[model samples]
Target: MAGARGAAALERDDPRRYGVNALETLLEGLVDYAGLFPPAALPMDDAVRNYAAYRVGERRGMLARFVLPVARLDEFVRAASRIDRGGDIGPWPLSVLAGPIDASVVAAFNREHGARWVIDSIEAKATTVGEVNAVAAAYGGLIVYVEIPVDADPAELVHAIGAAHLRAKIRTGGVTPEAFPAPAAVLRFLAECVQRQVPFKATAGLHHPLRGEYPLTYAPDAERGTMYGFLNVFLAATLLHAGTEPASLVELLEERDPAAIVADAHGISWRGLHASAAQVAQARSRFAGSFGSCSFEEPVQDLAALRLLPPRL
Candidate 1:
């Protein structure tokens, strides 16, 4: 697979972006907008419009790159041009989903649109060490994350990723109950990544901030299923990075009660376990990165409802 290089340096989160002191360190650029994917599965124009709006929105600080397929770069350029006529809404960053690796396509897109747009990262799958090595070698100049299966041990694949100096990705949930990984499986993935000194990002089925039963989709009759919370995933990863025990990590991921969790200026705590604000910031910036979400509003709304966010945010 061919890939391009060049992602701007990661910027530290400004304190003013989110007023919630407790969550400010954990949530900066925590969401990568993936509106084009399933569940939401928005049309291209609508997705482009939504991302452009988010770039200038109040909670923009919480948002990260726009996620799109590499093949749709042309379509994105056209749509982005139409929506942001003054070029005021860009230079938009993107994390392109890769299919067959074509170096020229990605490189050409960056050459033409690098000023107003950037292909900062690429996300692809690698079920084996060889695949991980190939992806790391091909995308050496850019930030690359390899998605590995979590049904079994991911130690070798994760180790390969760490050795390649790249990152890992996990699929946390989907449209059905079966789509969500068991809490133990998620815990294992986090533990592996932490032990191997590998950072990871997650995608799919993480719209809400807390784990609970929710409608699978937007349809009126959409069946509901238990979904893992973004807070749960990140917090667990943060704790895992800080040397918290595995048993405690599993409880954090499986915890559903909003009252059982606490987020304040000092830190975030679940039950009696605690991770200080400095620890949260370090874990997020180093080991645990952002997750891809189909709907940005859902997360923001959910956090506001939990009073984890300021009223104006």
Candidate 2:
């Protein structure tokens, strides 16, 4: 495919943009392998219909999942109620996005639908970690995921989230690649999550599959009144955690070679992403029996399949 030329182009680009502080030339060669495949983006929306439509459009790729963020439990219930009544869309898995303050909502949702709720810790109150942990423990069987800021001390977050039987996810924004976490740090976090047996997910600023510096855009949401792509957060984190070294990670980000990273197989080695299909199935089965089992779906299934889980089944 565009592997060779893409690699060369990446070498010419600035590796700093991809969040690696390593030898540029080495990073380029390492990233070349990632050029063989592509990355997928989840549909972004605040409206139920829009999210449903996004899921419908995501059937074409492996990473077409959907996440819904709510500020309150009432909002989540209202939205879930609407989705339940809106009729089935397809096979996409729908996760309810909530933060530390939304624990009551998560509890309420779990009570109503069990594992149908995915607790999200987006922009949460750090000071209330104990409260969040309590809620997470209360709903131990549900999919509890937390979003750690780029600057947040992941060690503590990981421990706190894990103790509560919740997964920890790293959150990012469109800052310079230099500001992104180190590959070693990302790997350590992933490894820790696996060791702790917690599954995590990423969100926002990951529109493209590969790593690269783009002219940051300011697409603000009218409702939330927030701008998008402020720091290229997703791309940087993907590069670091995509099962590669600092060099290759930087190369992919500099070149924006989504295809390369996906094909490398070794490059995108997230715990769930690279696990054997059987293993993934087992994980899903295990999750199904946990407090987070309501939204359990096979991780080995492509993103499209995962996204379609709630709607199709």
Candidate 3:
């Protein structure tokens, strides 16, 4: 849901930009801040502080999980305790990055910490179908997103993931041009997930809101690549799952024109078709889940530059 406070702020600043209200709803809790990851790989203290600030600020509504590796739960716990002000900032929900799931560490940490830190999700890599299934069964109630190989036939792994009732994960972009898969490959992955009724989340190289050529790293002279837009990926996924015009997907994923993607009070419109907020909400709830970014502010600032997040917000 869109935050009432944010809408009210926008209403006062420039009432006309309130259409951004609808756009804001489209991204509510849509990004899992991965400040622990590449590019803007801040230290645990810095990431924890930034997350705490965001959790209590205006854009808090847009904030999702604080992403960190499972191994550093203690580091986060220590850093967070000093800054969190005893729940004033957060009992932040987290999505742990791990390989070969053994959630006991996470479960034990949460149990002894007055539940101040809850590791409710795991994003793990899977090499074989059995590994995927084993992870699914091991996590019990914790939400598990299995990142499988998108290079070869992903059907069997996707099928197994779907059957086990775990969300699928996709690596949409990366540190190098070669790290990002072809647009068609991504589309195939999303289509298969949708076709299989399996929900998915995206990660990596999606710092910007729209797909365009961008730097692969934070270095001053970093190499550039064609990065997919978080907006394009999510919108394409939702529209595809809704059984909208199937052929439009390629263009949708590759669309660099932010103007081509618009949101009115009614819903999100791209090119020519529309997806009702209800439908997009459904997609967010069940089909296409959230993406991870190292800097939450980068995405929000991009939206602001596009006037999708006006001064009021």
Candidate 4:
């Protein structure tokens, strides 16, 4: 089981490496880290929609995963095109989490129209394993599993999500400081997912560089929420599952700034970025190689050009 999970983690394509709170992080990460793109949540209101459009337009070649309420597909499709008026950003991939409606309808729409999209079925709550499998079989393109907040064990979530045919997005932490999963615990959880052969992505709470003591800030959307540094979460997963050590992971996070972190070629430095880059590249090279097909270089090139890390050799 463990070996299978490791292989799965190493095998999945284009595991999105970054999530942002406001457009600032989104834009900054894109401009600075080439591969990092913001998964902007779809806003129900027109004012918020305009803001999202502005961000998307400015960050062309960056992938945008827009979340929409299942019922608002028509509005989402319309808004999505308008946001990409120059046709540079997208037909941005649309993602729908589990809700009241049958997920197949969304899949059917994408299939018929050749739309780029993904569907996340929140586990232990609105969606079931069968539902996730059915949707993955139907859509086949960019299926993700969302593990929502609850008392359920991460192991169970990993096993269940792994069993399904779709790819997975494991949310070990969120905006709330209390909600952040322990680094060791997250490592264990990721290891389990790796063992199960589940390919996943993460969302929310990760804004900083590493795990440890720090002042927490509230999320814009939620009053009580706070986000962690991106380095902390990303490094933890890489160390535990990517064959790096806790000590090395700590070294990368301990750097004073992004520049220092990006400079160290030997220590967890710029080489760290390649861990994700190589994993993504291999996944696409083996599985699919078309435009909509998954590839790590897309994000890696973006990140390299952005100077998020030393240029990829």
Best by lDDT: 1
Tens-digit per-residue lDDT, 146-256, candidate 4: 453333446665566666554555454543457666545555555565567665556554433433443333235444433334544444444445555544554443333
Predicted candidate 3 versus true structure: per-residue lDDT over 70-169, tens digit per residue: 8898898889878845435335678898765457786777688735667777998887888987887678777889998787869999999989999899
TM per candidate comes to 0.91, 0.49, 0.90, 0.57
Ranking by lDDT: 1, 3, 4, 2
Per-residue accuracy of model 2 over 22-102 as CA lDDT, tens digit each:
211111211101100112112221344443432324221122223444544455456545564344433334345555456
Superior by lDDT: candidate 1 or candidate 2: 1
How much lDDT does candidate 3 score?
0.79
Which candidate model has the greater TM-score, 2 or 4? 4
lDDT of each: 0.81, 0.36, 0.79, 0.40
Which regions of candidate 3 fall more than 4 Å away from where they truly are? 1-21, 86-90, 310-313
Candidate 1's TM-score? 0.91
Superposed on all Cα atoms, the candidates' RMSDs to the truth, in angstroms, are 4.0, 13.9, 4.7, 9.7
- Where model 4 places Cα greater than 4 Å from the true spot, the runs are 1-42, 45-62, 81-84, 87-90, 99-101, 111-142, 148-152, 208-226, 245-260, 263-313
Estimate, for each residue in 94-153, the C-alpha lDDT of model 1 and write its tens digit: 899873375567777888888888887889899888888778767757778889999998
Lowest lDDT sum, 10 consecutive residues, model 4, at 1-10
Q: Per-residue error at 305 for model 2, in Å?
A: 21
The Cα error of candidate 2 at residue 313, in Å, is 17
